[model samples]
Target: MKASRWARAAALLVLVGFTASCGLPRVGPNKREIYSGSVQREGDAFIVSVNDRVTRATAVVPALGFSAAFRNAGIVGSDTIRPGDTLGLTIYENVDDGLLAGQGLNATMLEEVQVDGAGFIFVPYAGRIRAAGNTPEAIRRLITERLADQTPDPQVMVRRVAGDGATVTVTGAVTQQGVFAIERPTRTLSAMLARAGGVAVEPETARVKVIRNGHTGEVWFEELFEDPQADIALRGGDRVLVEADTRSFTALGATGNQTRVRFETQTISAIEAIAQVGGLSPTTGDPTGVFIFRNEPEEIAKQVLGRTDLIGAQRLVYVLDLTEPNGLFLARDFVIRDGDTVYVTEAPFAQWSKALSAVSGTLGLASSLASIADNLNNN
Candidate 1:
């Protein structure tokens, strides 16, 4: 009986050792396993060490902007007339009962004179006159000259009212959505947004998109105000839209929170990203094995790896060792791009702890069974 008891104890010890060596369940692969599955070991992914040089090379911030054709375009004149515009004209005759007025009146008031699609307006004696592309003063001069031959020393005044010309359509995340005129104070992108009662969303995450002549240009709402060049001039028939940012990154493995986290600011560093997810798991997280998985474009991949042989987008795993002296600084400088996966591997000892706990529970159950057998035998 003593030999059997010793044999059972030895078997339990062997069983515990086998279970531990065979690998217990883990949250994720450890540092050594991750490294073994790298491109150097015929894996599909390339493993890169995040250092000062890599941080600088891969510190890319995504920016939205207009093309040269959109940015270089000149500002539209506020007073210029165009088709679908309303003009208010007042014509004064030097003498009563002249060509434009009766005996009691000296002026003829013409309100709501709409310019035709052909860019011409018809007056009594002026006939068909080109009104589009001319300012109110220019049109006043032309009408005066035309009526001078009919009425002696005729004086004319042309006023521009609410018109479709030089107007932009403002929509999306704004306080109000409507077609706004590109007036003197609201001719640029920033002014137009202000005229629409400002953006309704957070300024840091707001995105402004302008579509002109079937071409689209986009810029951040904050950037549109900060960068003067980004506040391009608005044109007639331009559609302006304001929206919120949609960029996000996934947090997995031994992180404090495993989920998809949206960007809270216009730009964020890796350290900020980890903090946004409640930081790493204090108990199970491996501080030396913080990894960032990203699919980088070919150009960026070349810059990051210093090699041009790779084509198209390449999968890259960047390792960050927070144990290093400058690791926090390095993380602070490393930009977290859209659609990145931040994974924190579990510490090596965490798996060992789990295995030891399992073994201890098994030994307790065996001891309980042995006590039951001895009690039955004594009975």
Candidate 2:
């Protein structure tokens, strides 16, 4: 009976050992598995070791800007007239009974003279005059010349009042969103944003976009204050939009948290990204197998790998060994882009510990069964 018990115990030990050698349940792939999935090893991903060279080569800062046409555009005249504008005209004639005024009056007041869609405004005897594309002073001169031909020494004074001409539409993430007239105080992009009650989102992450004549342009909100060149001039019929930044990276594997984390600032480093996710998991994280997965653009891939033959975006796996001498510095300098994945592999000893615990539990159950059989036989 003792010999049978020993044989069964040995068989159970072999079964547990076989199971442990085959595999154990894990949260993610190990370091060896990740390395085996490299392109050099016939895998679909390219693996690059993170170092000073890689950090320098991949240090890309994402920025928004306008095209040359938008940036180099001259500021528009605020007093320029356009269609749909309201002109307030005051006409004074030398004769007591003028064509525009009454028999006893010498001045004729025209209120709310709306410019038509064809950029023309009609007067009592001045006929139809082109008002759009001309300033108030130019329109006054044109009206005076037309009335001089009918009346004696007619003097015309044209002033622009509240109108819809040369206006910009401001919307999204602002204190007030509406169509605003382009006055002298709000002629440029920055001035217009201020007149619209400023940006409602955080300035660090605010993005401003402008669409004019189907050509679109974008810029960082902070850049408008920091760089004068970024504050492009606004045009008539311009649509301005302000919004928050949407850049983020996914944190997975043996980290403190597993989720998509947003960028808290304009630019973030790898160390900052790891800290954002609550750092690595002390129990299961392998300090030498921190990997960053990203799809590098063709031009960036060429610069990073020093190879020019690469086409399109390439899948890249950047390995960071925190155990190295300068690993922390490299991580601190490496830039984390918008749609990246930060993964930390499990330690080798962690898997071994799991397998040992499983084997010990199975052996303890076998011992309990043997003791039960011995007690029954004695009875």
Candidate 3:
């Protein structure tokens, strides 16, 4: 029993030494800038302070939801004829009427004509016809007029059978990325994406960009499905790009988890943020010190203090007190932006607990070692 006590004392001393020599995250030598009083609103571009009240404007992120930030471009122009196109032509003449049956052919003559490098197609009887920059309907009219001289009441049908001139290219973050054809007046952006097997990931965390006529525009992935106006029309030379967005916020301090959370959705609530990290540590967390750090807009900042600070006070801090019953409901309604920091302070008793535990452990080790030494001396 005496030997066992000595061994336990040695082991306990080793453990205590190891803990003392090393540094833990929040318990290390690093001084928290929060307590330095450096966060002042006067003459500073970036500022921080206590904001106990929640406002409608600051509590919501619209672009992640209804998207008031996204200005709809509305419906746009669609595909038009271009070079490198093939046309399917069908000519119909009354075979039984015996009117202009000079060739004695059947009721219909089917032909596939490819537009030449000069943007013209040659029909056997109609001669070279300009098919580029003109719709199939316009081509049919021109062909019918030309064939009128050869046969009475000539009927001509023209349609684009194959063409790169009327298609858009879809690339990036799609299962089957490729060029897709556009046949109607509507924007083919969504259809092309569907044909390419949709986005690789969910639309909530993706972004889409459109490049057309030397101009480029971008929108949130969910905008395409939620707002019809966001699906801008696809021109023949248009390019649609889809990309995954790994947006996230960091939860630190006395919360359940201390890691980054990727935002799969456009927005996340403050209450949800707390639950994600495993909620506040029941023993060591300060329920009244929950804080969210973010960069406030200049316009809103102007409203808050009436003018820009010398330091450009863009930094804003939000505090929530969970002890209050209404704070829970308010937290649920509060929205958190990307890259925001959620921190919970340590409880008042946390330091006392650490000190008491350390002292108790040291005294117990000294007592065990003294008892073991007494047994040895007596022997």
Candidate 3 or 2, higher TM-score: 2
lDDT of 1 by residue, 187-287 (tens): 89999899999999999999999999999999999888688889898888899999889999999888889999988898899999999888988888988
Ranking the candidates on TM-score from highest down gives: 1, 2, 3
Model 2 misses residue 226 by how many Å? 0.8
Which candidate number maximizes TM-score? 1
lDDT of 3 by residue, 9-90 (tens): 8876676555544442342111134434334524323333333344445664544321222235433334345676666777
Query: What's model 2's TM-score?
Result: 0.78
The local distance difference test score of model 2 is 0.89
lDDT of 2 by residue, 1-379 (tens): 9999999889876776676667688778888888898888999888999988899889887757999999899998888899987888999999988898888999999988989999999998889999989988899899999889899999889887656667789999999999887878898999999998999999999999999999999999999999898999888789999989999999988889999998889999988998999898999888899999999999888888889788899999999999899999999999999999999898877777777788888778989999999999999
The collision pairs in model 2 are none
On lDDT, the candidate that comes out on top is: 2
Instruction: Please say which candidate is ahead in TM-score: 1 or 3.
Output: 1
What is the Å distance of residue 349 in model 1 from its true position?
Answer: 1.3
Model 1: worst 10 consecutive residues (lDDT sum): 159-168
Each prediction's whole-model lDDT (CA): 0.88, 0.89, 0.69
